[model samples]
Target chain A: MTARRFLSDLSLTVCGLAVLVFLLLPVLVVAPMSFSDAKSLEFPPPGFSLRWYQSLFGSDIWVEAGINSLVLATISSTIALVCGTLAAYVLTRGAFRGRRLLEANFMAPMIVPAIITAVAHYIAFARLGILGTFHGLVLGHTILAVPYVVLIMQAAIRGFDIRIEQVAATLGASRLTILARVVLPNLWPSAAAAWIFAFVLSFDEVVVTLFISGAHLTIPKRMFAELIIQVNPTITAVATLLIAFNLLALAVLLLVSRRGRLFERGY
Target chain B: MTLPGSYESGPVASQTVAAAHDVAAEATAVPARRRASLRQWELFFLLLPMLLLIVLIFDLPILNAAYWSISDPKTGALTLGHFRDFLDSTAYLRIIWRTFFLSLEVTAATILLGYPLAYWATKLPPRWRIVVLGLVVTTFWVSILVRTYAWIVILGSAGLINRLLMWAGVVSRPIEFLYNEFGILVGMTNVLLPFLVLPLFAAMMRVDMRLLQVAETLGASRFRIFWQVFFPLTLPTLAASAILVFILSLGFYITPAVLGGGRVPLVANMMDLLINRFARWETAAVVSVVLMVVTLSLYAVYQWLREKNA
Candidate 1:
């Protein structure tokens, strides 16, 4: 009996650890392979070099895409942050009809599949004559970003002490003034975390951008186009950079929302 | 049709009446209630900008797509021709069936691999639990495209697995792993494992330890204790995460596009072809509406299961 128990426990341990390795294999393989000297994708690199990084930097297309991605993510996430935060505040505090319905409407973008959104946007933007325009791209990304911002800010607002806002109201502070001075300042950490989340989401977005981004190219779109044509080592460099950027953003988010448990669902 | 339409509008008509009655009462109510109504208006003003943005950008696009799906392109007359075309064509149906089955396979694979990991994490010491979970979360943060791209490097002809296999003399030649269903499954399972594990781990942690102890003390074997006591407790969350994974896999575009190399076309890829390649906007709209309805229906079930777990 003891031996059977030991065998079962050992099997569970081995399987669990193997799954963990499998989960991390992509990160493990890509980061190391980025530095490979081999022309081909060779594992356990023959030698370390920055040729791929050099190529990635040397390419105008890649650099342009990177800039486009940065600017788009910045603009879209900022718009989403402003709009989503205010909507979340009203949704949380208001004693109004259709609040739940409105909240669901805001979150519908996130819940719906990206492909459907891509298709919908492709059709709609074609009609609006903004199919390839940068503003259209920003609007597409902002829609995607809004849900995360709303989710994060809603949790933050709910966690905040309503009594403090009430006290301010009782002490003759206007609602807007109370919000600016008392609430927004305290919710800054969570707001920052939500912004970072939206930024990462927009930066990493591919499907919607692929459909709607006519002339403009973002990093993922470029990587995808290159990947479809052939295997390029420079893509390894881009992937590595993206992984690093995402991890840094995640670290900052964790630091900011440590006390909030804002990520209870883990997206 | 009329029965269903009237049944739907029945409550809506009564709801309008009820709302008007409430408004009349509120207008006649005391000063504090009047002040509360004013605050509601203030909240509405605060909410208006975002609402306008959402309606213009998000809602309008989807509604427009639905309109396109049912309306004639030139004449602007309502029709079911696109949906009829969708049903008449076997290619679209084949792709839809393929997507459903592939998503099911991915969900099953995630549950098989993820459940044990979550259970094992619950058995670990506190410090080790954090380490394990952090690794999962880190993988979650990594871009899905990057993760999907790594599979090509790891599974391609001259890639890591093939190279190791050749070096070990396990095979005389490299295996065809990329641009196929096998590659899609592996990449998708890898990408989606965290979605299952994180929530399942949290759910496992929330399971009552005392009940398991009581079962053990009551002469229950470890196997029976786990299967009878622990597994049942975690089942709702397990079921919920499984549904969530399935829902995500159904909509997966990146992994299949990158890893499948266009060989295995899922619903999303099919939609892409319909819109971009085939120039069939109305058909794409039809496909999108179908996918949306299916996704939302499953999501309703997933939310129900999650609430049950809570």
Candidate 2:
């Protein structure tokens, strides 16, 4: 490369690396703090220990909340996946009236603020006498997550060939049979992507969970409550574990979908 | 007209024609059955879950919030006292202005920082592009609470930046980075950077490389080509990201609460304080309504701009 081009490239690399560091620094800061031996939050701590993590694991409240979060996320993601995938199929494949309106309604949750949704759900569930229940939180989260699933599944379905299904219909196969055998097989990657996206949305959800989940405490809510009371490192330990889980999940997803061209397919 | 063939034919022939008509009717009815069944199943299985959710959670709650906002507590009379209080109080109005300006500032900062990073990412090879994009999005996976705490550490009085500055003899004392507007801005920008970057990157990636090359072939300078061609195409993405970041920033609670240390109160914080601390659900409801209005207006503005540009 010419000197000018080389200099420009070097500058770009430096800037890119700087941005990366800026993004990573906050996350990296918590790792050391989580391991701090001191009671208060101290950087470059006097010593390192696993006391905070141990404490987090030993606490019943923390354990229960963690379990609650996992179960809620699992159930909600499943609901979102099923509903979103079906809607995606109908919207993408079927030539139906009001399809645009249905599609827009499905995605409305995403554009609305989570807090508003939460408050709305809180009031509605209260009137229905389901407020503060796990079922309520699950229902709310499923709604929040459906938009993501629909978006991902819609993208996946767009790449599918309608002619394949048509061919199946011509060859003595029922439409249901074609959908079961041909369409869903090709939809696996999108389904998996939707599931993962839903999982993350539920797992990280806080604003809505705060209002709707009256007595129930999901992990994020627990962490927020703890933060308000004190600057606890146990929360940090939870965050550290959550961050690790995210990375591991992302890694596994990347591995499994290696041949799927996920980003190119618009999930 | 049909009587000639019927009368000439045997009883068996007539029976065969009847059976053929029956078979044809069955074939026609079968497809109708299948179509109806599929439609019924789609409505029940595919659409019902989301529809029920929207009705019970989304539709009802919004209506209730509006109702709660208007209902009067004293004498069980309907009144607009909550909104009156919100509009009447200087403190509340100031809080509203503060929240608006803070969101605007954070959005501005994110655009300024994120655009260059996104532009740079587009220049890299595809593999590297994915890696960079992943890195940017991975930040999203990290909880906002943790990100805020990280900022506190970095911007705290005896924190990383201050300590480094002090050690480097750049300052004599630790600066007040926390519990102020600057601290909130720093934290908010850090959290919102990815929102700006992703959309901007999406737009920048769509720019035709050949266009820039052609400009270069025609003896246009790199800066001139970028200014005249590339920048104009990226404006819509910039506007979209700005709207997104601003709306997200408007609903922000945790970051400002932690970093501002109660000095900077956004609308979300006001809602919390009113509901939790003051036992003023009416007031909280009013604030929530106002916030919804603000967010919706911003979204409307974005749509309008997009339509006009189109």
Candidate 3:
């Protein structure tokens, strides 16, 4: 390559990596800052400390929100798993009229902007007198999570072997027995993906929840309130830990997929 | 109508159906009996929860919003007075315009910085490409709240950028960065850049490198080849990400509210304020409807453009 071309390539690579750094800067900054001793968002911290980490672990409000998010995510993911997986099965396995329209309806909530969802949900929940209730949170998060679960489940179900179920049927297995024994096992990876997706979505969701949420606060809703009201290092520690959680989850997902493929080869 | 996956089920299902029909011709035929009973039973059992969920959780709220917006005491008698009030109000109109322009600006920034990065990353070898993509995905997966907080640290009066600038003697006083339009732009662009980069990189990687090599063989300048050959092919990707980012920015609540420091009121934040502070639920609902209309119209236009080109 000519000198000019080499120079151009070098510059482009520099710019690209700089942008990559820009993308990663938030997590990188928060990760280290969580270890910092400063009360404020200070740079090149005077010293490292774990006081903020201890604060998060020690505080009742933070602990309660964390538990709330866990419970909410679990309930939401379970509902979404059942609903999305069943819909996926029907769409992929059952031959029916208006399936396209049915599928689109499942996806509509994903497209409708969150703020609008907040308003709509607020009105309905208010009328029902369930605003700020546990069931309301479950139902709301489930609606948000179902479409993602549906997308993943549909892809999984499309790759499924219907012949396995037919063969089981020939061996005198009932439909439910065939599903429980054959279909569910193959679709476990998809179910796992669905659960994680729903869980994370429920955990991260803030905007709509901020609107319709009652007195009971999830972690993100609490974080949103805390950020607006106070600038504290404890939240940074929480964020750093959340990043670690996501990494762990991603690693688990990789293992799940690898195991799934190995199981497919074996079966 | 025939089911979608029926033919793809191959002969196993067809043979079973034939066998079921051949056995007793009617009363005990497995396919017919199962079809009439199992299909309905299964459909009722399986599809009902999801169907009810979509209705109760998704549709009912939306219908409620629309209903209340029309029937509320302020806008009652089924009139468009609330919309007219919004249309008539100069402040509300400006908020809507500012939202559109801000979304446009952020989308443009992401594309401008994202294009070169996406292009170069696509040219990288596998190892480097994975590293680059790993960074981008981690950023994308991380919560927006965390990122917004980091910006507060970086843009604060005593934050990193100002501290460095002051230390360099460039400015004796710290420049205001957080809680302003500039901060909002920076925070939002930081968050949304990966949205543009990921999709654009995927599109860029699939481009025919041979086409560029052929153009090079034809003695076309590198710049000419990029502009005339490469960039045009990625226009659809560019347009698609631009609209997607813009629509997302339109509904942006957290970033602007946090970064704008209570000054820069985007429509979403304004709507929140109207509902929460002012108790103008009907007005807020109308604004949401307007945003939905605008976003859907843009999406429809995009769909039309895709179809027209096809």
For residues B1-310, write the lDDT of model 2, one tens digit per residue: 0000000223653454455554444444446666656655654565676677666667667778788889886664778888888899999999989998999999998987798799888888888888788788778777787788787667777678887888899999999998999999989999989888876787787788899899999999777898998999899878977998999998888888888888888888877777557867678778778888888889878768666644
What's the C-alpha lDDT at position B56 in model 1? Answer: 91
Q: Least accurate stretch of 10 residues (summed lDDT) in model 3 chain B?
A: B1-10
User: Model 2, range A165-241, lDDT digits (tens) per residue?
Assistant: 55555455665677678777766765776788789789888888887788898888998887666677787788788
Clashing pairs in 1: none
Which model is ahead, 2 or 3, in terms of lDDT? 3
Report lDDT per candidate: 0.87, 0.77, 0.79
TM-score of chain A of each: 0.96, 0.92, 0.92
Q: Any runs in candidate 3 off by more than 4 Å, and if so which?
A: A166-175, A259-267, B1-37, B74-76, B301-310
Q: Pick the candidate with the highest lDDT.
A: 1
Best by DockQ: 3
Error of 3 at A233 (Å): 1.7
Task: Compute the lDDT for candidate 1.
Answer: 0.87
Please identify which of the two predictions, 1 or 3, would achieve the higher lDDT against the true structure.
Answer: 1
Candidate 3 local lDDT, B205-238, one digit each (tens): 7688999999999999988999999999888877
Tens-digit lDDT track of model 1 for A1-267? 999989998999999999999999999999999999889888877999999999999999999999999999999999999999999899988876777888899999988999999998898899899999999999999999998888888877886766566655555566678778977887887888889999999999999999999999999999999999988899999999999999899878877766324233343
Prediction-by-prediction clash tally: 0, 1, 0
